[model samples]
Target: MYRLTWFATNYDVNREVNNGRGPVDFKISKGSRDKTLVEFKLASNSKLKQNLKHQVGVYQAANNTSKSIKAILHFSQTEYLRVQNVLRDLGLSGRRDVVLIDASPKASASTVSDFNQKGFDF
Candidate 1:
């Protein structure tokens, strides 16, 4: 599981994610100055990450702004570094930067949480 690092940053207000076949997870904006392509991935399985990179490419094509897809960032900091390393080893550029951050405390966490369910932990 992973939580978004951007969410922890100071925010103006909560925003909505446009999921009409766009490349990233959600649209995060910094005031009116910048926008980002935030792609969240928890299970960096060989198959899943490979597909995500492709999705990043498509995501770039979908956006009409000049800001660029900021990053194809995976937020599973505690345990997925190896997989992230492998993905970086491939050298597929253009908005790919795997990030690591302590997982966010879930609003409603199960006492016995798996910590790998794909969101709310990173």
Candidate 2:
């Protein structure tokens, strides 16, 4: 969420902005310019495909901006692959505004298990 906070200094950042169609997770703008709609989702969300195809476009239109961004976080390999398919289906695979963050615990996360077995808290 550091990026979101960082964006606030130059733009008016609004949360859960409803534009008659649905709520946009974030609406960012600098005065009357550079309006950007941002939506976030878990990669496991079943409605991800549907929303990306139609809902985001409508939000951009309603917000009167041509720029929009979608951020998805994946908690597993399965979720990451599913997002790839959906991005291809929506022709957003190459779009710069669509962002995917891998949130899965890394293999390194278990490297500490050996230390834990020795009852070390640090």
Candidate 3:
């Protein structure tokens, strides 16, 4: 997993190798005093959402961050725009200093349309 604090003079960035099904990315803390959680997926997978939910919920609770822990889903291309949309609507888009990066411009737009048309919950 990778851990990094952004927009700071000093930060922590750690990349941990995955052993099985686990995270490989990092999330900036809601505040230096608060806790953060993150997950990175290079490919689009339906199970990613479930992982997101758990991270934002159970994981946050476990960490005891009442200020709403941050989350980042690093995708390589259109494979993850679906998740980005949900994050955007929730005001978690990169424009808001939440989202991390885009997988691909083409796939990003297509993923949005595809998700909307197929009624998939990104």
The models' CA-based lDDT, in order, is 0.50, 0.87, 0.48
Q: Model 2's lDDT to the true fold?
A: 0.87
> What CA root-mean-square deviation does each model show from the true structure?
9.7, 4.6, 11.7
Candidate order by lDDT, decreasing, is: 2, 1, 3
lDDT of 3 at 72: 45
lDDT tens digits, residue span 1-122, model 2: 63567553866888889978888999888888779888998899999999888988898888889998899999999999999999999888978999999999876755665775778776
lDDT of prediction 1: 0.50
Cα lDDT tens digits for candidate 1, 1-122: 22345456764322334445543555556665565555555544446557555765565456533333323334455345655565566664333354443353545755746776655456
Candidate 2 lowest-lDDT run of ten = 1-10
Best by lDDT: 2
Better of 1 and 3 by lDDT: 1
Those runs of model 3 whose alpha carbons end farther than 4 Å from true positions after fitting are 1-32, 67-77, 84-100, 105-122
What would the per-residue lDDT of candidate 3 be over residues 1-122, giving only the tens digit for each residue?
13323545354433432324344344344455754455454336566555554544554454454434243445454656677766655555554324455544354553464665667676
Better of 1 and 2 by TM-score: 2
Pick out the ten consecutive residues of candidate 1 with the lowest summed lDDT: 64-73
- Alpha-carbon shift of residue 10 in model 3 (angstroms): 4.7
